[model samples]
Target chain A: MTERIVVSPGDLLGDGVFETLHLRPSGPWLLEEHLARLVRSSSILEMPEPPVDRIRSAISDLSVSSGALRVIYTRSGVLNVSVSTIPATVLRERREGVRVLTADLGFTVRKPPPWSLSAAKSLSYASNFAARRWAARQGADDVVWLSTEGYVLEAPTASVVWLDGGVLCTVPPEEAGILPGITAEHLLSLAGPAGLGAAQRMITGAELSRAGAIWLTSSLRGLAEVVELDGVARDRSPWTPRLLDLLGF
Target chain B: MTERIVVSPGDLLGDGVFETLHLRPSGPWLLEEHLARLVRSSSILEMPEPPVDRIRSAISDLSVSSGALRVIYTRSGVLNVSVSTIPATVLRERREGVRVLTADLGFTVRKPPPWSLSAAKSLSYASNFAARRWAARQGADDVVWLSTEGYVLEAPTASVVWLDGGVLCTVPPEEAGILPGITAEHLLSLAGPAGLGAAQRMITGAELSRAGAIWLTSSLRGLAEVVELDGVARDRSPWTPRLLDLLGF
Candidate 1:
């Protein structure tokens, strides 16, 4: 589906929040979760409460059956919903996994500024994109950010999840003060059904290296296994396909 | 004059740079400096060099005089120039001074990540504006950010400038990894003509408190004297107006 939008200068200031969902034949995947995150993001930006009913109506009006759905809401009260085909790279990463690098993000987990937007997926995502580009320069498909103290944080655009001692775990959002990963949390909830344990805990880079399997989870990519990390190749995990199936990817 | 335009989804990602200039009867004040800074900002964001000739032509086409001139350029090669009346609060701040609060920005000066955009004046200004709103909630007009080590950094939207022993100084942009302040540099250049010395140095918050005068300098506000800092009232210095006149504000 093709779409166009008229925007004011203020809307371009990045003082906004947005949600990207994996549109399916049935509907956008986990849409309510994405919308809830959007509201949380807006609140962090100190923006007015988004009109959720209006957003739902807008999504229902879209003619495209499956692709990517984007909802953008600016502080200027502009709301835009559009549909487009998901990038081939996203699908490729899901099928083939991704090469990942680890780098110190230069931020301390314990001392965010009072107005820190770390917990919000604000539209100020230049650094997020920049980190990916820097990874590309290093010949990696993506990056997993580490806090200055060597603790594993989230990826640039995804949440870091791993299997350790038969237990599935992801970083705790509140303690890390990061954007809560909806997809990772959902996947963790499914671990019990898959005959595994689920938990949320902090891990250092060294501890992460010892995990049985590592993956980055997001809405569009679903779960991209870190097939290669820090130049070391990893054997394909048997759980990768099963987890993808469980998530309906 | 009012204007509207169409933007792509990528345009709202805050992956661009902008310059806010003071439009004057004789054209934009310090236009060259502002343009140079724009180039530097774009470079930091890995965007291609902005078309300087196009920017100059666009500025020449504006009919409005003596207001705020905003130039926005996205990574998608979209360039926009618009004019709007300066906010009355800006002029008032220049005249009446501002109550300031000092807060730890929770950023260490030495460890910015490889892809950090801290030095760029990118469109991702949501955090900057959020900090100001936070200051407002704290019963202050503005805030001066301090580094994690308690060194004085710039304000949310301006540079920190202070006077000591008849010498006027501001933090060095490169050393502080901040957006260089065009107005403050110009003011410093004119300090010799105003019978004062100029320098760039790093100082702690305590040292800044003991300075004869302190100010936050930006394009629109010119020089907002810090009349009260962290509940401690400061005496007005004679240099405020003389430097303002020298800068032709």
Candidate 2:
């Protein structure tokens, strides 16, 4: 059933922060990290601190075995938590990988505006959705945004991760001025235990094309491998399953 | 009492478009242009055409003499019309002039991304709200954004207009890739009758400081003269009252 909430007009203006989690039979995956990021995003938007205790209580009361859970907090002090079944498309992307296109985002990482919300997971996701639609129109499943200077930034909804030699690398969040991807950070943190080196470095799009493998990481999708980059088909990497297992996805 | 609507969680994501108009005793100001722009904005976002006839009916049914009327349509096909008292600050800014600041938006007009919604008034207004808050923090009343190339762009909630001797000027919407301001365009259309010429041209931030007069134009505010720019106080322009009367405010 679709969940609904009563909201004032101001609440619909997208002046809010949200977190989507992969709710598993065990619990909402990375609950603490996602909540932490939610608070951080609110701070960035200058919203009042979120009601974490009430949010914890709400999450604990849910009986669903597994699904996608979303926590939203608006500037008008509206808080809502809803859970829905994971989309078939998301699951397909996880299993079969995604055909990706690289496009210039028309933003420079060198100097974002003082009030830039690029680093926050704000509710204003129309552009993100539009970019994906543009990719689909070009016969690709998703897009990786490139800065005007030709540096790889990230996918609209995911962090760009690539394997360079024995290292598992994602873009440095602070340096790139992007939302810190919890899944990518967790994977990189576990790289040593899995016998791999982890690093966060800025990579050019051209250099990224030559990486051993690439993946787009997020909370629910975990990691969707880049099956094809700018129309060139890539050989399936054996590390795909190993990395998925390492993350216990 | 605050009005409310029951909406699905998706409705709050800012994947929508909206228009605000001055609801006057004479009826909603510039109703036709706003509705047309609403449709154009919907097209830009790739959303379905809005239910125009229904919207017309909604407006016709409103009996409140005056206020701010907002029409909002989401990607999920939800349409809402609401009216509320104009804020005291808006009236104050209209009667008095505003202290303005110029900030680099860090976006180049040379090449906006293919999926750019900068020209559309999307509900993803968190960034716009943030910019205003940033301006307020800097001891300014409002902001006029400049492209990375130093070309003056629009303000967060209004369009920038200026007078160069006898010609009234504003940034061309198409060339600047910004939203077309109904109030500014209407004012420019009537400029000749008011014994002033009008033009749409690109002006740099530096050049703007020397203009005879400047104002931020919008539906509700009509025009707020720029009494100050970047910490320097500007003398009150005699044209301020004349322009306000010309707009029938």
Clashes found in each candidate (C-alpha, N, C closer than 3 A): 0, 0
- In the range B1-249, model 1's lDDT, one tens digit per residue, is 457778887688788999999898988999999999999999988999999999999999888888999999999888899998999999999998999999888777878788988888999989999999999999999999888878888998999899989899999988887888998898899888788899999999989999999999999989999999998999998888887887787
Q: What is the TM-score (0 to 1) of chain A in model 2?
A: 0.99
Cα lDDT tens digits, model 1, A126-165, are: 8998999999999999999888788898998899999998
Q: Flag clash pairs in model 2.
A: none
Residue B18 CA displacement from its true place in model 2, Å:
0.4
Worst 10 residues of 2 chain B by lDDT: B56-65
Per-residue CA lDDT of model 2 for A1-249, tens digit only, reads: 989899998888999999999999989999999999999999999999999999999999987868999999999999999899999989999899999999899888988999999999999999999999999999999999998888899899899999999999999989988999999999999999889899999999999999999999998889999999999999888888898888777
Q: Model 1: how far is A9 from its true place, Å?
A: 0.9
* Candidate number with greatest TM-score: 2
Best by DockQ: 2
RMSD of each: 1.2, 0.8
The residue ranges of model 2 lying beyond 4 angstroms of the native Cα positions read none
| DockQ values per model | 0.75, 0.90
